[model samples]
Target: MKRSYFSAPYAVWMVVFTIFPIVFVGLYAITTRRADGNDLYTGLANIGNIFGNEGTYMKVLWRSLSLALQCTAICLLLGYPCAYFLASKDFAKHKTLYVLILLPMWMNFLLRTYASMGLLERNGVINSIVTALGFKRLELIGTQGAVLYGMVYNYLPFMILPIHTVLKKMDQRVIEAAQDLGANPVRVFYKVTLPLSIPGIISGITMVFMPSVTTFAISGLLGSGNFMLIGDVIETQFMSANNWNFGSALSLFMTVLILISIGLLNRMDKSKTGNGGGKW
Candidate 1:
């Protein structure tokens, strides 16, 4: 059969939008301003500057990784059960529930984060409720906990939706056969359901982890300028510090980190499913 040319436009779009931007960033990262006000190829000079400032930058990188890990863990813990329930026969019959699960995502993410900001602020709704009950007002905002909460809240759906998709599409007979073979519900889940869901879980982890690590808006709004993440630093380097080269270098480092993470996750997925096909 002759292949259709329908993918040609999308290939062009990918080159223009994705490939071009990456190449541009790479160029910016490697080029530096010379003494005569002209640009010169620095080779690894910009990367060297990143290493020189490794003290602060590494600290920020660690914090970003830690928070992103926390957020991803929380999302998996919370989303897995929710997804399993929603994918069950009972809830699958009620499609409206799925719509409701995705309703918050339909709204603007910035708006949702801003609304979360209000709820977590010093004198926000929670504080008001606490004071109403004669308890001390809680200072939730501008803390690492608050940032972590914002990360989970924003990215939880990313974790849930993929897992639900996998579970809903899973073959029922595999689970039934396991049960028929004297497997209890828990054993069936561990041996059959959980193993089969590895692909979805890995995908969900990628979705949650990447955004959580790279996000600046949630940290900025919730942390109230108190916290400084790598994303915030990159933004400051470009916007406030007027250091595009450094920003580009940092962006390159971040991209490499994300790629490494994705590679590791893919390796784990391949080990679980064997042959890298993710098929049972």
Candidate 2:
């Protein structure tokens, strides 16, 4: 069979939109500021600066990673049961509930973050209700808690969807077989369901963690720019400081970090699957 001309268009689009832009940014990162204020060739200087001034940037990276981890943990802890519930139930009865779970995702991300901010602020709805009930208004805005909440709220669906997909596809007979073998519910879950659903868990975790790590808008809105995340650092470097080279270098470093983490995750997943010998 011969390939169609449509494939050529897609290839051209990929080169123009993705490949060229990536190559351009990488090239830009290695360039220096000339005396005439133009970006000139200066090999490795920008990358060097990234390592040299590692204090703030490294802190931001750590903060972003920490937040991403926290979000992933919380999502898995909370979402797993919900996903299991949805998966186990009849499709007709659970349809509305599933829709409710997904409804929030349809809203704009920025709007959702701002809504969280409004509710979390001192004089916002939550605080007003608390004060009306003769209680003190807790300060939730501009704190790590708020950032964590925003992250969870935004990415919870990403965690739930993949897990639900896997759980729904699970064969009920396998679970019954475990029970027939004298395994308790918890034991069956740990030894069978959990291992079987790992691919979905991995996908969900990656989906939530990657974007959460690089989220600047949520941090700015919920944390009120008080927190310094890696994403915010990149934005500040490029937009505010007008340091393209440094910003690109930071971005490159973040990309590399994400790739490393994902690689490790994939290896662990493969090891688990290999050890299990597909029994799970």
Candidate 3:
């Protein structure tokens, strides 16, 4: 079979779905719907409104970015240790552990987040335990903390799996060579294992950070709609506010931001390679 046969389907899919939607959004973003239901070309008007001095929507963008960075940092901190342990040769049950890590992710993302709501609700399991222990019932839901927890819980596996795969496939001989050279366990990990796992770390960071920025459902369910992320603002513009032009503008901005993030991360990965990240 010709390679064109395999490539044809993907090309069609991109044209119909990806390319078409972007073109549609771009048109809507650059035009304004007049009171007569006619869309007029407005040039940079919509884009300006988003980043203009009076554009308070910029705050929502910053908040989403801040939360995404925090979520990525937290996932890296928690996932690296777990990945390190799982990749250890002495961890005989690593396969079973891998399955456990993947089990929750198999469920619908919305359903998993909804289930978390039950745990964080006022009369929910966690608050019940607090009350039983004679402590005051903590306000678990409808807060920034709840939203952050949801982001971390939902995305942590993405961080772990990549790092685990990288660590597991790493050359054991390189690690042993470091040990033989009188490098302690900590030194070997810092200088060798960690550097070798940079690709996976970068993959995990991008994966978690991208979705975290655009997630509106988690904040809706967990934050009780109190937290307005850029995603939520875009959703409101398109759905409730009947402002397609502005919504499309926000969507375009975010798409550009995400693309820039991926480009920067790729550069970082290349720089790590160029600098011989794993060198002793």
Best by TM-score: 3
Per-residue lDDT for 90-185 in model 2, tens only? 655678888999899888999988889889999999999999999988999999989999999999989988888888888889999999999999
TM-score of each: 0.94, 0.93, 0.96
Residue 139 of model 3, lDDT score: 96
- Give per-residue CA lDDT, model 3, range 89-181, as digits (tens): 999999999899999989998998889999999999899999999999999899999999999999999999888888888899999999999
Looking at candidate 3, the ten consecutive residues that score lowest on lDDT are 271-280
Off by over 4 Å in 2: 3-6, 90-92, 274-280
Candidate 1 per-residue C-alpha lDDT over 170-225 given as tens digits, one digit per residue, 9 for 90 to 100? 89999999989999999999999999898889999999999999989888999887
**Location of the lowest summed lDDT over 10 successive residues in candidate 2:** 271-280
Q: Against the true structure, whose lDDT is highest?
A: 3
Q: How does model 2 fare in lDDT?
A: 0.86
Off by over 4 Å in 1: 92-94, 275-280
Model 1's alpha-carbon lDDT is: 0.89
Estimate candidate 3's alpha-carbon lDDT, on a 0 to 1 scale.
0.92
